[model samples]
Target: MTAAKLPAIGCEHPMAGIARRTHARVPPYAFYEGRKQDWRFSMADEVTLVGQEAEGLAARACRGAGATEPTTRSLVAATMSAALFGPPTLGFPHLVDYLDSFRDGRISTNPQPKLNRPFAAFFVSDADRGIAQLGFDQAFDQFVETVRHFGVAIFTQTNSYTAGELGYFVRRLAAEGIVGLAATNANAMVVAKPGGPAVYSTNPLAFGFPMGDGSPPMIIDQASSATAFVNIVAAASEGRSIPAGWAVDADGNDTEDPNLALKGALLAFGGRKGANVALMVEMMSAGLSGGPWSLDTPDFRSGDVSPGVGMTVIAMMPGVDQAARIARARTQADRLAGLGVFIPGVTGTSKKEQLTIPAGVHRRIAEFAANAPAAGNMSLA
Candidate 1:
């Protein structure tokens, strides 16, 4: 496969502005404060990059790691959004996983994603063992249009690398004034119950809906597990023990040692309730998409083959008087906030124009860029 020329590097996509405006109220630094030790970086060990520069660097890094231009563009946009508005771990840190997969042959550099419409309201995609974002990117316009026409649409994708940030999918729909619920599975690493074998991945689910009052869309994104897998990995890297009930040893005995937990399985967040949520996500994502179950998927971190996970996104148009309904919801949210209730996706405006990256993470990204082959010299085989 021949490499495509890189697109212009900038956060100029339609979602970029909406994400920035909606997430402006979030205090950017708060996400980084408490976990400095686990992340192995202090606030002082940080470098700031303008959004455009960060996106450019991310694109270069992806291209250097053998991704095609289109793949790089899709992944860079998602990465920047995650870094800017979503969880910090899912942003630049997660890009490292994609770069490694590209170099290790776990992900196709130039996958030819194929879309199928078996029904008027349902769309299916084969990612050809590439990143999940590209498949969604390709189907987005059509999916949104379908939702508008039919009042509801469902998109399912199979045979892709693990989704980097599940919230990214729904947030895009929320930007278009649609409600979106998205779910994706990874390799099996979570157990349904104490003393049970692993039967689920972290199995994240995300929901987003437009508020329509200049307030950011309300987004709720979380893993069904007690915590994210990345958090465990970070703890292990920092030689720290995790909280109790987070995981169990390979023998199904509860363990707080991150290393042991890595060898074992993560526990669900609310015991049976969280496990049920994981099961629900698995059914919609892996079951509905014809993708491999978590038990059957390969390890995303170690294998040369793709994990071949699945993602399902359901979009729904609001009811009659959509604008009025959305405004009412916003008013309710404000009233709840006044009662000291924690509202998801509502934060104070952030004034900073640039994003801060931990120096260590920035160095790793820089290395990928510095080592990338020249555009015409790339090999996609």
Candidate 2:
């Protein structure tokens, strides 16, 4: 189908508006700043692209893969944020999943997300089987305003694809000087007990607090599972065995085989403790948002149907003594660092403007863009 003939998605001109609305609130990209070193690819197998070039290529690729204009913009922004600041696996690698979903009818190419404010400080959105980022993007302005006015606000979304990186939601709030916590769930792949059936997704959670000293926010983002599902997939692809605690075989016995793990369930990090955390995240995300439970959600990898997961983000405004409190926190953080405590989100400022992506991933994305129908007047901003 021609780009012009595609059904209306959300906003037709989302890039210009998103760029303006988010320019001051989103943290600057720093080329994988604070990202874990283990996720990096070998330099020999990587290709470098300027930030703008990466954005342009990703946007075109999304459109070429049958995503609508608004969906393309939202996907591009979130994917870029992940690629530049969050984990490498959730960055360009994850976008490939969405592109395939769009082509396979697992993600609606022209979703029209709908928003509702059921209460003064409670907002909900239905993503209409589209990417999760579009729903959050649509409600961001109002959500921030609500948080500022009420001191706290809760934003929940349902009927969207699985969230890419939970930290991306809270990080935006931290940039605005607000403390934030976010949680999201996906299809069932994690077992609460070592020998039990899968009862939760990875069920990740993130928290962010602005440092108030012009540095990055103190952010903590992690999955409740021992390892992310992607790691298992990667191991299986490389013909490697996984760690014993990572997952269990189909018979519910712990195993070190990645191939067997794929047929079984992932284990929680700290046994029952991690399972409890996963339960809390499940309630906060899927239960509160009225989305399907992990047990009921479809698998994201092999589905022709949408997983339709949910996300919950809570934004809290600092009190009237916000400046003093923030300063004190920064001072305490400095003292802790001096005492040899490793801070998760503290990193030196990086002036790098280019990203090193896996060459194979880059070529695949470029191929999508090259094969796509012409997108007339689509803004790369």
Candidate 3:
């Protein structure tokens, strides 16, 4: 595939005294043609393509990496995780470069700069993509263990794709009675406001605080932007318009057009307040973690590019009287429930909620897995 040139950068100046400045830049037009524009296909047909094309290439890379077993497992695990948390189209292909980087020794498994506090830092420098959660899960488990021993812990991961929902990583800590906050930075996709140059990456933030009872943890997850980039791509692939205020055109004008949004930038959700939070996330994920700033990150929507993103996980133990604290929180939740305010992630959801993959998608995944071994992939016991 030929590389698309970056559009020349220029911004339309706002009328005098308007206070809002827009970035004048055009998005790379052909960047998404392969996936978003030419996406019309039967589910089965798409699945076949994923199996025959995507998986076939992935299998070859795994063998070349010489870590076939772990790489194959990571690919399957990422695929399963994506299926569980939707936008399934977004996660798996990213693994191609990640596995290759691992084989090439571009990614380091060692933690950097030993810390006095319970902290660990990992840098996957080579635009590594998939298996963020693999590292995240291990880091979270270690963080939880460390927090249990030291009262708090922090885990920083830099240079990976978006890594799905931040809440998914911390909720595991909450299950063990630990409070957790997770954040990540992405490629520049969200602007501080309409008519503003894109400056942030939606910069998701999530918190999981245990409520003590057997009920689910109190989980809060959201992108600071009005919408996530993946969701924009999903809408574009489906030929659906996005909601107004979710994104802006190249001129920084608000637009509901998904195609324009893909080319433009997303708006912060709550205006300045959301942008402030996004800034905080950027600091924690990229600034402190030694990852590239969102503007420097490569676009993941286009084929196997490292997102150059970063993630931070903070885990802490509740106070000494954790039970009492939880009871107090439960009282507040009960009061809110009396007022018809459901405490999401706790009172309103079932832990047993089933994840159902469409037949075609599932079949395609199965076919890919089956073909992988014969195509140079390895199996785990």
lDDT tens digits, residue span 38-104, model 1: 3324424566788877877788789878788779888998998788777766788668778988999
Considering only N, C-alpha and C atoms within 3 Å, which residue pairs clash in candidate 1? 24-349, 24-350, 25-347, 25-348, 25-349
**Candidate 1, superposed: residue stretches over 4 Å from native:** 1-37, 40-44, 229-243, 256-262, 348-352, 372-381
lDDT tens readout by residue for model 2, 1-381: 122322333322222232233222111111122232212332235667788878878888898888878988888988887777776657886677778788888899999999999999999999999988899999999999999888999999999988887788887888888899999888777888877898887788899888885677777888888875545555665688988788887888889988787678778888889999999999999989999898888867554899898999999986777777677778887898899886656654343478877655566577677756665667755
Which lDDT value does model 1 have at 114? 98
The superposed Cα distance between candidate 3 and the true structure at residue 251, in angstroms, equals: 1.2
Q: What is the lDDT of residue 366 in candidate 2?
A: 73
- Please give the lDDT score at residue 318 for candidate 3: 80
TM-scores, one per candidate: 0.84, 0.85, 0.67
What lDDT does each candidate get? 0.77, 0.76, 0.56
RMSD of each: 8.8, 9.4, 10.5
- Residue 67 local lDDT, model 1: 85
